[model samples]
Target: MNFDLPLADISTDIWDTKYRYRDGDVIRDASLEDTWQRVARALAAVEAGQEGVWAARFHEVLANFRFLPGGRIQAGAGTRHRTTLFNCFVMGTIEDSLDGIFSALKEGALTMQAGGGVGYDFSTLRPRGARADASDTIASGPVSFMHIWDSMCATLISTGARRGAMMATLRCDHPDILEFVEAKRDPAVLRHFNLSVLVSDAFMVALDQDADWPLSFPPGRTVGNVRARALWERIMRANYDSAEPGVIFIDRVNRLNNLGYEETISATNPCGEIPLPPYGACDLGSINLTRFVRAPFTPDATLDLDGIAATASVAVRMLDNVYELAHFPVPRQREVARRSRRLGLGITGLGDALAMLGLRYGSDASLDAACAAMAAICHAAYRASAELARERGPFPAYRAESYLAGEFVRGLPEDIRTAIAAHGIRNSHLTAIAPAGTISLLANNISSGLEPIYAYRYQRNVRRPDGGLTEYAVEDYAWRLYRSLHGDAPLPPGFVSATEIPPDQHLQMQAALQAHVDNSISKTINVPADMAFSGFETIYRNAYALGLKGCTTYRPGAGRGQVMTADQQPPAKPCCELPGAD
Candidate 1:
C-alpha cells in the first residue's frame, strides 16, 4: 500500500491526496463534513511528527497552530506565531552607528534576534559622510554603516535560529545615489539584505513630463546627477543589467499604509513583501499558487474554475493550522497577533501553475487570469477564514464598522456573524500571500509568487546539519511547462531555470501578476552581476503603472558585504544551539 503524506511529512515521500483540498468549492460549497475530513487528515500527519524537529520546523513565531474547517488554520494558540514575508505593515529600522542617528546594530540586532526581519534607510546614515544616521562628529557614510548591520545580521542570527533578513531603503533625493545603486554591483551584498531605492511620486511625474528632479537626503545630501530621466535610464539599465537596488516608490509606499494613523511604516520584512512595525516580524504562510489555476481553456485556454476553488478551500485550512504549530518569543508579539488574524495564503510555483495550464507569465491572457486567480484566492481565503471564525470566532479587531475590519465579515453568513459577536474569532486577518519558501520546496519547486524560474539547473549551495556545504540542483518548473505545452508525453514539466530565459520578462511578469494580490509579493528580480544600472527606471514605473503595493529587486552591487547566492537553502537554517538542542 502506498502510505504517502504531505511534502514535508517524513512518513512517506509520495504525495498524500487523502487530505487534499478540492478546488472550485467555496466555504459555502464545502459541506462541514468535507471540511472536517481534510482537517483531521492534516493534523494527524502533524501530530505524527510532534516528537522531533518536524513539529518545530512547522512552528511559527507568535501564533498557535490549529486546524480550522476544511484543513485551514487558526492562529494565536500557544505562541501567536504569525506569518512572515506576506504584505503587512511597514517595517523600518534606525541603524545607530551615526552619532545617536538610530539604534545602532545593537537594537536592530536585538529586534531581529527576537524574531524580526528589518528594513533600513541607508540614506539617513549620510552619504558615506563623516556622520552616518547619527550626529557623531566623524562617522562613516550610510553605505559604510550598512555593512556594520549587515555583519551583525551575518554574525547574530534570529531567535528562530534563521539568519536575519532585511531591506535597505535609500530615497531618490539622496546624494551618492550612484554609489548606492552600485553598492551591490558585486555579489557581496546578497548576504543579509534586500535593497531598493525609495522613489517618490514626483520622480514618476518627472519621468512622465521629461523634467529634471532633485535628489536629496535630509536636506544635506547632494543630487549627483542631472537629467532625471537620465538617472532613471541609468537605474533601469542597472536593473536590466544587474537587477539590484530594486526601486520602492516612497510616495506610494505611504499611500497604501493603513497604519500611518497609528505608526509610520518605512521598512519591510526580509523579502520586502510585508512592511512591518519597528521590531516587526512577518508571520507568513501560503497556499500553492498553481493550485488555483484550472486549465484547458475554452479554445483560447482560460483557467479551470473547479481546481482553483478546491485548492483555495484546502489552502485556507492548511494555513489556519500553521498558527498552532508556530513558536514565538514574546507576549508582546502574541498581543500583536490577537488584534488581527492575518494568514498569507499565497501561491508558490506560479511558474508551475501557469505551466500546468499552459500560460506565459508575461502574456496578457496569463496576466489577466493571474489577477482573477489571485482575486479568487483572496476571496476564497477570506470566506473560509470567516467560516472558521464562525466556529473559532472572528479575530478580536473584527468590528464590522471599523477600518481594520476584515472584508469577509460583511459577506459572511448572518449566522456566522452572530457566532462571531458571541464567540469572537480565532484569527484576525486571514489572507496574505507570503514568499512560500518552505511551502514551495515541499510543493515541488514551483515558481515563487508571479516570478519565473531563475535558473534551469544551477547547483544550489547550502549549509547542512553537519556544518558542510551541500549543492542541490534546482529544477525549474517553468521550463517543464514550457516543454509540456508542446507535447503530451504524460510527465509534468519537470523543472526549468530562469537564468537561460529572457531577463526582460522578469519585471513585466511581476507587474502583471501583482495586480490581483491584496498583499505584496516577495520576488527578487535577478540581474547578472555585470548587468548595467541604466534600466531601473522602467522597472520602477512598472510597479507604478501596475499599481503594486511595493516592489524589491536584487542587483549584484546591492548585496555588497552580503551573501548573494543560494546553496541548497533550507526552509530555515541551522542556528546556534540554544539552551536545549535536540
Candidate 2:
C-alpha cells in the first residue's frame, strides 16, 4: 500500500495520498475549497427540498461564532463580515421581579424567534419558599420560571426558521433536587429546554464510599441524610430510561479553566460541550484536522510528522484570521476578544480516519493511533501559534513558556519574532475542540466529537415551516459498511451499538485525546436509562482520573427542563402591549 509522495504541491498531495496513509496517520482535509463546495451542496439540498428557513440561516450559521469574547452582530448588507454568537445570560429575569413574571417573557419570545440560543442557571432564583428582596413577594423557584421561559420558546420559531437552542442548569444540592430529577417525565413540563444537573467532585466521591449524600440546597441548608450511593442510583435509573437530564461536573469545569477564576461557569452552550458564563456567547471556528497528512499510506502504514507540522502552520493562520473576519456584538465580547482572540480547532471524521487506515473504531490499535494523532496536531497547533507570535507578535497573553505570561519577547520563530516586534498577531488563544454539530451533519455522515454511532440509521422528523414535516435518516459508518459489503444484504442480527461498546472504552478514547487539547473535549457518555445511576460515579471518576477538563453524561429525568418530543407541543406566545397601555 506504500507509494511515493511528492513534497511539492503538498496541500493537494496530502489528501490525494490518503489512500496510502497508514493505519497510524490520517486526517480529514481542512482545505476551504472542498469544504466550501460541500457546504454549498448542503445548502442546495435544503433549498431544493424547499427548506427556506434552514437555507436562510445557512450563511448566518456558517459565520456564527459561539465562543467568547466577541459574540453576535448584525450582518451588513453591502459586505459580509465574519459573524460571532453573543448569548444573553439572564435575558428575562432580575429586571422584572415580584409581580412582572411576564416582563422577561417577551425577550425570550423575540430572542428565540431570531434563532438566538439562551441559557441561565435558574438555581439563583430563590427556592420554592424564598422571598424576592426587591418585591417582598414569595417566589415559585426556578422550575416555575422555566415553565414561563419554555412557553415563550414554544410560541416563537427561531429566526422563524430553525428551532432555538436553550439550556437550564440547576445545582444538585437545590432543595427541589427530587422534583428536578423527574421533571421531564411528565411530558407536559418544560417543552423547549435542554436540562443538566450540576454535580461537584465532593459529591462524586461520596457515591463510591457509600457515604450519605445531601439532597439539600440553600448554600447553608442541611446536607440531606441519604447515602451518596443511593442518590447516584436514582440518577443512573433515570438515564437508562428517558435520557431526560444530563449531569455536569461543575467543579471539573472550574479546575484549570483558563477563565475559571474570572467567573463561575454554570451552564453550557446548546450542545453540552463549550461551557460559558451566563449571557456569554463565545465566538468559535475549527481547523480541519485532516490537513496534516504528509505522505501516502504504503502497504507498510507509516506516517509523516514533518508535513503535519507545516500544514498546521497554515491552519493557525486561517484560525487567527477568523477573529478579523468575524463581527463581534456587545462591548464585553469585543473587550474579552481583544485579550485573547480564541478559536477552537477541533477534529472530525475520527472514525473515518481510523477506518481509512483500516483500524476498528473501538480497538486498542485505533485508540493508540487516535492519541498519537491528537498529540501531533496539538504540538503543531501550538508551534504554529508561537510562530505567528514571532512574526505578528504573540497573543496579548502569550508568555514565553508560562501560560499566563503575557509579554512576548524571547524565543519566538525568527520570521515571526521580527513581525511580532513589528505588528502583533491578531488573536490570543488559538485552539479548542467543539462538537461540530451542523458541519458534521453536512459533510460525511460521521459520528461527531469522538461519538460512536448512536444508531446505524435513525429517522429525524423535522417540523417544517409550513406546519408540515420532513424526515431525515442519519446513517452511521457501520451501517454504511454493511451496505457496501452487501449492497442488498440484510441477514444479520445482534448488530453492534455504540452502547454495545464498553464504558471504559469511551473514557479511554476521550482521555487519550483530551490531554492535548487547550480548552476541553465535548464528548457525551450515552448510558442507558435502565442502567443504575450509581454507574455515573465511576464515569465521573475516570474523567478526572484521566485528567480531562470536564465531562457530561445523559441520564433520564436528570433535571427540571423543557424539551421538544413527539408527545408535547410548544405553548402559545404571550401578546402584550406598549410601556403604559396595558
Candidate 3:
C-alpha cells in the first residue's frame, strides 16, 4: 500500500475539483492519499468490532488506486454529509393514479437531492387519452409526466455537484411506445433523462417475422398495431440522428436475473448498467486493471491473477460495507437496500491493460484475457460474499434454492456455488461494468471500463491562473508507456484505438465479459460516423444474439456533441476570467 506512485498533474487536478472532500471553506483532504485515508477511515468505522484493522486493509487497496469506489463514495464517505453512498436507484413502480405518480416524483426528488441517480419504468402509467376513472378526464400519458421529472432533475443538483441523472424506460408493448421512442427527437425535451426502449422478446420475434405488433395498456388491452420492423426502423433512424434512447433487452435481462423469482427488473441506472427492480440501488466500485499488469509491451507480459482476485475480494467487502453505511433518502430505498444488498464490482482500464500486455483489444487474445480476468473477479467476489455471509449473514431477501438456480449462479464454479449454497451470499448481484469515464480520467487517463482507448493522444484544455487556457496532450496510459519505452516510434500492432475496431468486435468483447458479469454493462460500441443504418441495426441484433442485456453505440456526428478529437485547436482565454487577471 505504498502511496508513492507518480500521479499525473491532470489526474490530481480532476480529483481535487471533482472528488476530493472539503469542509465549508477549508480543504480537509488535500491530496489523493489524504482523500483515500479519509474515505477508508469513514467506511471502516462501520466494521462491527475491528475498525482499525479493516481501515488499514481498506487503505491498503485504496492507497495505490487499485480499488476505486464510485464518485459518491469518494466525495461523501468521510465528509459526514447527508448523501447516499449508492450511485443510482431504480424507483418503485409509478402508480397510474394522479396522486401515486406525483408521490413517486417527490421520492425521485429526494433521492436526487441525496446525490443518487434514479430510473423509472413509465409503462405502468396508462397511455395518453386513457380514461381517468374518478376525474372523468383523459390521462396525459407517462411521457408528459416524465417531462415533470426532467424539470425537477434539472433544478436539483446532487450533493456531488452534478445535475441529477435519470433513466426513463418504456415497454415496447405500451400503447404510447411509439411516442415514447420519438420523445427525444427534439433535443430540448427530456434533457436530463436517458431514455431506453425495453424491447420484449415478443417484439423481437414479431420484428424478425415481419409481422404486426400490438401496442397495449392495462389488462391485455390492445390500443394499436404497427409493423414491428417499420417501428424498429424509426427507432434506429432517430438514434442515428441523435445518440439517445438506447435499447435494453428487457426479457433477456429478467430471464437471466439472479433474483428473477422474487423481483422483476424493468429499468436500469442512468448509464444502462445494473438493471434493478423497483427501489434497487447499485453500490458500485471498480478494480484498476492496469495495476495488475506485470510487464509493459513485453513478450512475457502477464496479468496478475492473484492480485486481481485479492483486490476484488477486498473491493466486494468495501462495497458491501457501503450498503451498511449508506443513507437512503426514501424509506422504500432503504428497505430495498437492506433486502437486496446489490454491489457492482467491475473493472476499469481494461483496454489499457490489454495494450500493455501487447494484445490488441477486440482480438481473440484480448477477449480470452477479458474473460479470464472477469471470471477471476466474479469467482473471488462470490467467495468473499459467501465468507461475509458466514459472518454477517445473507441479504434479507436471499433465497438459497431460487438464487442457486439463477443462470449466473449456476454458471459459477462448483466450489463457489457450494459455498454459496451452504452459507448464502451477502449480495444478490455482484458485478457490472460501468462507464467509468471520470474515474478513469482521475486514474491518469486509463482507458474507460471495457472500452477501447478512444485515441492514443488528444489535446485537453486546462484553465491557467492568468485567465488563459493551456492545451495539454493527454496520452492513453499504454500509449504513454509505449512512448516512454520506444521514444516516438510508431505504436505497436497491439495499440488498437476505438475507431479502428469494428462494431462486431465491440459486441464480442462485451458478450465475453457479460458472461462473467452477473449484471448488465455500460459500454458504448463506438462506430464510424458513416456506418450504414443497416449495419447499425445489425449491431444491436448481433448484441442480442450474443446474449447481451443492452446495447449502446456512439457515432460522433452533428447533434451528438464531440467526445474525442485528434485535431489540435488554438488555446483561448478561460470562460470566466478573474477580475484582475493579466
Candidate 4:
C-alpha cells in the first residue's frame, strides 16, 4: 500500500480542502492515497469476515482514480460525522393539507442536515385559490410551499462545505402548472432549487395533436385549459431566458423502471440521475473511462472493454456496501434504502476517452463506442450484483418474477438476464450517468460525464497579492495528451468541444448511453448563445422521441455566470491600459 503517488497540484488542493478525512482540528489523512485508503478501508468493513481482502481491491480501484464515489461519500465515509453516504433522496409524497406540508418540510430539512440532497413532487399539494376546509380560507399552492423548502435548504449547510441541493417537480396538468413554469422568471426566486416539469405522455400526445390541455387539481377539478403547444412554448421560452426548469418524461421514467411494479416515482435526485420513490436514496459511483484507454492519439489506440467491466464490477460491490455501512438521516430513509438497495454506477471521463481513441464526440463512431462501453459496464454490474445476491441475499424488496419483466431488465443481454433470474439481484437499479462536476476536476480535469470538452485550454484569472489579476493557463486532459504526442500541431478532427457539436448530436449520445442505463443519465445539451428559440425547442422533442427519461439544456444568457471562455480571437485591447500596469 506504500508507493510514490504522482499527484497534480490542483487535485491535491481539492483533496486537501474538500475530501480528506480529519478528526477535530487534526488532519488524519495527508495525501490523495491516504484519502483513498481511508475510503477503501471504510467501505470494505461492510463485508463480513473479508474486510482486508475487499479493502485491498477497493484501494486498487481508487489508487489511480479509476473509480469515484459521489462527494457525500468521499467526505462522510471513514469519518465520525453522522452524515449519510447517499448523496441524494426523493422525499415521500407531500400531503395537500397544512399539517402534511409542514411535516414533509421537516423531513427534507433533516435529510439535508445529514448531507443528503432532496427532491419533492410539489404537484401533490392543491393548487392556488383552492378551499381549505379546516381553516375555511384559500390554499397557498405548491409554489409557496416550495419557497419554504428552499429557505430550509439554504439554511442547512451540507457536510461538504455548501448548501444542500433540491429538486422541485410539478405535473404539467396541475392547475398551477403555468405559475410553476413562470416562478423562476424572477432571478431571485427558488435560488436553492432546480425546477423540472414532469411532462406526462398525455401532455406530449396533446402537443403533437395540437389539442387543448386541461389544467386540473385533485378530486377531478378542471380549473382551466390552454393550447398544449403554447404551454410547451412557454417552457421553452423560460428555459431560453433563464434555464431554470428542466423537463422529465415521467411516463417513460416509470415505464422503464426496474421496480415500477413496486414503487411509484414522482421526483428525481437533485441532478435528475436517479428518479426514486418517496424516501428513496441515491447511492452513486463512476468508473473513470479515461483510465481504461490503452493507447492515446495513435492508430493503435483502443478502449479496454474488459478493464472497464472489471472496474465496474468492483465499483458496484463498493457502492452496495456503502448502503450497509453508512448512516441514514431518518429511520424511513434507511428502510427504503435497505428494501431496494438502489445504486447508480456510471462512467466519467467519457469525452476524454473518446478523444484519446481518436473519435470525435457525437460522431457515429463515438456514439457506438459509448453504447458498447456502457453496455459492458451495465452487464458486469448486474452480474456482480447477482453474485452478491447468491452469497448473501437478494434485497428485501426483490420480486424475482416482476423484476425480470421490467423494460430495462428485459433489454439486457441474455446471459445477464439469465444470471439475474437464477441468482436474483442485490440492487434494484444500477448504472446512471451523473454530472460528476467536482470529481472530474479532482481526476485531473477529465471531461465530465458524457459531456464533450468545454475548452481544451483557457486562461483562468487569479487575484494577485497586490489586488491585480494574473492569468493562469489550464489544459484539459485530452489536450495535454495530444500535445505530448504531437507538440504544437493543430488539434485532430477528434478534438470537438461542446459548442462545436450540434444540439441533436448531444441528445443522440445521451440516448445511446440511456439504453443500457437502468436509472437516468445527467447530461446537458450546450446550445450556442445565438441559437434560435425554435432550434432549442427541437432538442427536447427529439429527446422524448429518442426515449430519454429527462432533458436539460444550457444556453449562456444574461444572468448565467461565465465559467470558461472558448478559444477564439480576443476582442481589441481597451482604448488605454489601466494605471496599475507594470
Q: Estimate, for each residue in 344-382, the C-alpha lDDT of model 2 and write its tens digit.
A: 555654654454454555678868877776666566666
**What's model 2's overall lDDT?**
0.51
What C-alpha root-mean-square deviation, in Å, does candidate 1 show against the real structure?
A: 9.9
TM-score, one value per model: 0.66, 0.68, 0.94, 0.93
Q: Residue-wise lDDT of candidate 4 within 370-473, one digit each (tens)?
A: 99999999999999999999888889999889999998898888988888888899899888999887687778878888899888876434332233444445
Candidate 3: give the clashing pairs: none
Model 4 TM-score on a 0 to 1 scale: 0.93
Displacement of residue 388 (Cα, Å) in model 2 is 4.0
Instruction: TM-score for candidate 1, please give it.
Output: 0.66
Q: Where is model 4 poorest over a 10-residue stretch in terms of lDDT?
A: 573-582
Which parts of model 3 have CA positions greater than 4 angstroms off? 1-5, 158-161, 460-473, 568-582
| Number of the candidate with higher lDDT, 1 or 2 | 2
Write down the RMSD of candidate 2 (Cα, Å): 11.8
RMSD of each: 9.9, 11.8, 4.4, 5.5
True-vs-predicted CA distance for residue 7, candidate 4, Å: 3.9
Which lDDT values do the candidates have, in the order given? 0.50, 0.51, 0.84, 0.83
lDDT of 3 by residue, 414-505 (tens): 99999998999999989999887767878888888899888887765554323344556677877777777778887778888898999999
